[model samples]
Target: MPELNGILVHPDCRHFRGDIPCRPNKENGYLCADCPVYAPVQERILLIKLGAIGDVIRTTPLLRRLRREYPAAKITWLTLTPAILPADAVDEILKLDLASTLHLQAREFDLLFNLDKDKEACALHDTIRAKQKFGYTLHPEYGVAWPGNDLANHKFLTGVFDQLSLQNQKPYPQEIFELCGYEFQGEEYVFDTHQDKGYSWNALPIGKPRVGLNTGCGDRWTTRLWSDEKWISLIEQLQQAGYAPVLLGGAAEDERNLRLNAATGATYLGHFPLEQFINLLYQMDVIVTQVTMAMHISIALQKPTVLMNNIFNAYEFDLYGRGQIVQPDRQCVCFYRGTCKLGTSCMEDLPADKVFRAVQASVNA
Candidate 1:
């Protein structure tokens, strides 16, 4: 037989692209360094973030920094929701589908960053075709593991235990940046959407310092929701205090919004799709809500925000000095558990008066 050609030996290898020879790998398997042909690939970057709308939005700040660092690199982002990303920021957008997954596995990339911690995401990071892998990954037996970097390890350690997380002083974005060896310089959120749909405000008189109360905390985190009575009390108090209280929520919150509106005579702005809801959010002078998508939107719009957070790590939020974080007077016993073990939720213990005061400060500022 003719001499075995290393270049064509593993043509189907995930890293086998064009004339580029794979790196020498005797121990791990593919001995690319001994390949006959060698071709260097252009810088290709991959980012996988997946779902949870709020998280997808908060991660946009990384795009700016990444572009700055890799100006000529072709950036490809994989996300479940693509509507929220800036139109001109990314070079390619890949949805979380079979075709996209196959394409990613087959393609060669210089760097890959998987920000999500889900098993699926971690597995993808561990198996993808990239010279370097950053962010979280799955160990075959021990569950999710970081890239063995000090900063990333610290971030991962904090996530595993509540005690460590409570001591975290860096903001969420900064933590991610540091994981990639980049220093955070106060980057803000970027939310560029296709504003094809329009929402009519019904000519409601424009009120200065318009205050919006976001009543829903999403289905997964019921521990963040304030009591119905607390909401009603805050709405009534805001109105009496001379502020326009607009009730905001999705279909899940319709009944609650209706009840609150009827009881307090507050303006109930019916929920629209994500894009339309964001449009309405821009009209508000300030937003009051349990840490949710609404709070993220308010921060994206640079609107003053009064954020109520209890179970989640407070350090995760970076409101850019435009908001105040309100918590229950008592230390949360159910921190990050999503469910409250106590008979009454810590959120319920958060008095309406306290929320009202926070709202007032935000509205006036």
Candidate 2:
């Protein structure tokens, strides 16, 4: 306990901040001694999961279990995409940068979890001061990333070897929960929908079920892309089926979306910023997308989703009983390869009719 102006300060309180007056004091004008909302943090836990936005979103299920197991713990999460994390769930959401690294190195945590296998994340895990550490860390002797504990061996193995990844049936949430020594019970993703921002899309037609078509699979994985022709076909089919098909993507898919809109006359609202993009996705009754950020967002929003898969394992995703995973009829020769080795992508085998049926099923369900 620290003395502030001769009054004992509850530094262990989750809302206590040394730099400024805590929220309770500012809002209610109550001293720490008489605060009703005071919550003493029993443990300090650090979670390092810096990566692609989808991975960050999917990792949120662990927070549910962590809260259940350690209700009085103050959780700090370090990530590159801090904006995507639910603000209410995490006590501290620090963007992974030089300043964050320095802050983390200085602070001591009761428990630390480094979920990313990236060298930078592992290296930080190795140097960070923590009483106990779980998940992956940079090996002190070999200068390579390795599991910090035995429980992370399955996740570590699946990450490094494509063969093991293909054979593994454990979903991502289960794997991460096991790494932290907990059983996964179908925890839902914690997401910030940005509904507070008050974004609206008047251009979207009413009276029909809005079907969002997320067209891009990102440049890294060209093998995951469905052909423009396929998208056009799907859009036409959706419109004919009395569904209002909406084109969805960022700047990367703008041109394709424009082409689809011109060809099929589907609703093509131009791409907006990330926050607004999330809000736009929220309007959809059901979303049809590749295994990208939109897919994870749809899952988080609890929207009926139809996920298209080609390269990654279908079993890795836990849709929380709200969606279905549709894969190519032909087996993907490239398990995790960005470029297809088979001259043409196997996504061709997954017909537009199959995807339309999936969308129809998801909407009807």
- Score every model by TM-score: 0.83, 0.97
The lowest-lDDT stretch of 10 consecutive residues in candidate 1 is 1-10
User: Runs in model 1 with CA error above 4 Å?
Assistant: 1-42, 140-144, 193-198
TM-score of 2: 0.97
lDDT of each: 0.79, 0.92
Best by lDDT: 2
Compare the candidates by TM-score and give the number of the best one: 2
- The number of residue pairs in model 1 that clash at the backbone is 4
Provide C-alpha RMSD values for all models, in order.
9.2, 1.2
